[model samples]
Target: MLDPQRTISALRELQRRTGDAQGAQRVAYTAPWHAARGFLTAQLAELPVTVDTDPAGNLWATLPGASDQELWIGGHLDSVPNGGWLDGCLNVFAGLEVLRRLSEQYDGRPPVTVRLVDWADEEGRFGHSLYGSSAVSGHLDPQRAATLTDREGVTMRDALAGIGVDLQHALKAGTQRQKAVAYIELHIEQGPVLERQNLPLGAVLGTCGVERHRVTVTGRAAHAGSTPMDARQDALLVLGRLSQAVYAWTAAHGGVSTIGSVTTTPGIPTSVVETCTFTLDQRHLDPAGLAALWDHAQRDLAQFSADAGCTFAVSPLFQIEPVPFHPALIGACEQAILDVTPQAARLPSGPLHDAAEVARAGIPTVMLFVQSLGGLSHNAAEDTLDAHLDLSVRALDRLAERTITWIRAAERHGARIPAAP
Candidate 1:
């Protein structure tokens, strides 16, 4: 039986260990995250499970079954800088609860192999995101990641070395693994949608596609006071116009566009910027729409730069296409939600997740989201009501049970899961 109080107690313990007054400090590749991992290890110490770590520093604790076919449950253990106590960590701890509960009910062995994972560096401690799940999906390029360095100038290679992950062998690590039949993740909503609707939890439709770019506009620098207004080719001015254009485009299209960072040479009021660079992060739920939007934005930015007498350059960043959840699994989750909270809603995730990577690996995947209080996230105040937390846990446990039964029945009947509608 699922124990809501027990689950909350475990979550509280994790919070105590990894979170402080400032919030969760278990950022990936940091000392606090290692301590958090140690705490997880201790929790699984007495359980009948074989715990292991991959070359990417992802932790896996497996409960053996009759066959190698596995139902995987996991989430990232890492958090953003001073992020909430229950961002990536919530799903990881929820997976732990599933393991603990199932282990007790089944006497340490389930009918199907169940594996719980703590994905490493999902918050991109070393300048990129989705490190561990992408590695497992065979999409992580170790050679490329090797060149990445943290804000501290610490190379990803060196940072990984601290955790015993040899970058050269990272690619080979994912090759030797059991076949995953499905993956389920439980996470906080991280938005206000559910809370505003007075719902405690929801079933995720899918994660949005993301297109990121580094845009650079080059213009001649000059003294701000002395340069003639008509003769000046100020990159900063071009940037301002392009930023507004981006907002306009996104407002018309159904998506989000953010200029996350900006930089300029000789950043002073006395000088016109010679070069201006900014990061563009765009996301949409529809794949084709996302591509079209990006194409339009790129063309607009190029034109804007040319009109301002500035040269334009676009540097492609990483991209993850929209990933829809498995229809059968989503149905299972929806049923579980309905059983607990009949008013629960179905929503698409704007933020990406490790589940997207897992789905890309061709495993059936679904996610459950608990409401985030006041839509607050990435801050110390990020939280869910205790009642909502309990409701989500119960609902997720029901989904897990339902999914296991469905998988077992499918295996017996020699049938494949239904396709998404």
Candidate 2:
């Protein structure tokens, strides 16, 4: 039988063993992460599944079934430095419990194969997020990834070598998905939407598209005491104006924007700022909306810089289109949530997950979100109510059952599975 308490206990045990006063230290490529993976391996040893590590360092535990078609449940085990306890590990442990129940119910053979994946380095400790998932999905560029390094100046190549992963061979991990038909994940909302609505769980609509850029404005520096305020060309002034315009435009368009960092040259207090650089991150659930947001930012930067008599440039840092989940799987998730609560809420994920990469790989994918307390994540204070956590596990199990039924029906009727939008 499925046991939510058992899942919760496992989570608590992992936290006690791997976490510390500062927070979870399960950062990938570190001793704590190795211990966490070892612990997960020990948990799987009790099951009938076979386990292995893919070429990209993703861990897979597979339970053979009557059919070869696979239904994937996945999450990451790695955390940011001093990160929250539940951010990534909850999905894995909860899925582990669900796997245990299915094993018992099916006498070790399900209707279709079920696989649980613990994706490696989803936290991007080296600045590249979705490492393992992207590799398995054939989206990672080995040459580019080889250039990445952590704060300690250890190359991603060297770090992976420590774990027996050769960056050059990572793309071969794509073969692991040869029989995968659908993927589902459970995660914390990492935001305040559900809690604010007094809800315990939500069905994720999709992951938002992101437009990340670095904007730099240039002006001639002058002595602060000698330059008149109105006559001076201050790059900082242009940056400030651009930042305000971003907020206003995104607010009107129902999107979100952040001016995450700002740097001004000529640091001395007595000097007029000659150059300023800032990062702008804009996100929207709709592709058109994301494009419009980017357009607005460009126009604002041009207008603000011209008005201030400063020249400006924008360098693209990263971009990804919105990834909408498979409609059928989304319906299954909604139904599952409704099993636990009176109503099921739907929302778009502003944050990315392994499901995004899997969906982008043309595999049907969906995600379930449990409420996060205080809209907190990536921090020690991140938490969810115990009741909500239990509900989340039950809901995820329900989703798995529904997905299995859907997959079987699709096969029976020869129905074409839908892909991510």
Candidate 3:
């Protein structure tokens, strides 16, 4: 019922107007976010919806249905530095389109309320991924506020303060909604599986577990010309071998892993490198595998460093266990995919998203993934065709309808959401 091409252009422009080469671009509480947030809020007025911001800075736009509260139909709006257009933008815009189209298609609202959410800082510019979603889910510890920092040494307190959000509240992990409802987040697959298979849409299996760490390699700096290879403790060589081992392990395990960022000191050509550090991000479908990997990596650090003539250490930055979306919600997504495109399949998510946090919050949440052109994201070149976008929006609309109906039925029968406590 809508041209997704226009929506994509509008979204891309929103990014262009706000992103910057410096600072964490498009981060929460940043000027770019303000620009995008302002645009989105202005758009909400057309739908005759009521809007408000939550304690954790999550912006909520509500369209009332026959039932109580809202269906919470949207997704995060934050992005990685210079992230692609479709990542979280698709969810927010597509959900808006769903509401608009639903208004035109059906004379009355669906059986339940619908809520559009733009969760703050889903990218966690301060490295708190799912920050907003997790805060609302009562998952973030209030005392951990002191631990977060950006590259410029700006704590979450300062960054949030710049946006007029109080850091103290961000710690509370506020009220969990206990309602007769389900959540459906539509996102790009961010991987090559669907595109390689020529699939237009797919059902989300689940969000994978994540183990991210900061590994530091320390070695003595020496004069480049004077020190022989045998005498010098070169950190880069040790890190190189460590990187290869990490990549090979994750690849062999049917999971995913990578060294996403690398940092080295003193870029002088003549100076022997004194220190080099790197960030290792590892993911898997099971917690046991993650733990095993972490254990092995920790155990190997001593010998690996000794053999490579450097000192290596692995510090656990963050760990999130894999989360399964509700089975019924998943089934509804499958049916919706079949309705829109015949070539849809089920695949687990490699990239972490808000759906994982929502699922952890005890909501019966599920996701529908559109095919990415080259299975690439967090890049300017990431893309998906309009057909795929249309397929995703249609599937999400179907999911919203089914979920609303299910919620109403469940409420009538006194079904309850299990408490996160």
lDDT leader:
2
Error of 1 at 388 (Å): 0.9
Candidate 3, residues 270-337: lDDT per residue as tens digits? 76776788887878888887776766566666667888678877666666899988888788788888
Q: What is the C-alpha lDDT of each candidate?
A: 0.84, 0.90, 0.76
Candidate 1 collision pairs: none
Model 1: per-residue Cα lDDT over 1-421, one tens digit each: 6677776787778878888888888888788898889888898897899999987778999998765678898887788877898888778777777888899899888888899999888887765678888888888888888988776789888988988999877766576344778889999988889988888888999999999887889998899899899988888887798778887778778878888889998788899899998888899999877887798778888887888899989877668999998888888888889889877688999888989988988889999999999899988999888888888878877888887887777677776443421
**Candidate 3 least-lDDT 10 residues:** 412-421
**Can you write out model 2's per-residue Cα lDDT over 1-421, one digit (the tens) per residue?**
9999998898888888889988899999789899999999998999999999999999999999898889999998899988999998999999999899999999999998999999999987766778999999898988988987777899899999999999999999999989999899999999999999999999999999888887889987999998999999999999878767887889888778989768889867998889998888889998889999999988888988899999999876556789999887898899999988898899999987989999999999999999999999988899999999999999999999888888788777776453311
Worst 10 residues of 2 by lDDT: 412-421
Q: What ranges in model 1 sit over 4 Å off? A: 415-421
Model 2 clash pairs?
none
**Backbone clashes in each candidate structure, one number apiece?**
0, 0, 1
Q: Which model is ahead, 2 or 3, in terms of lDDT?
A: 2
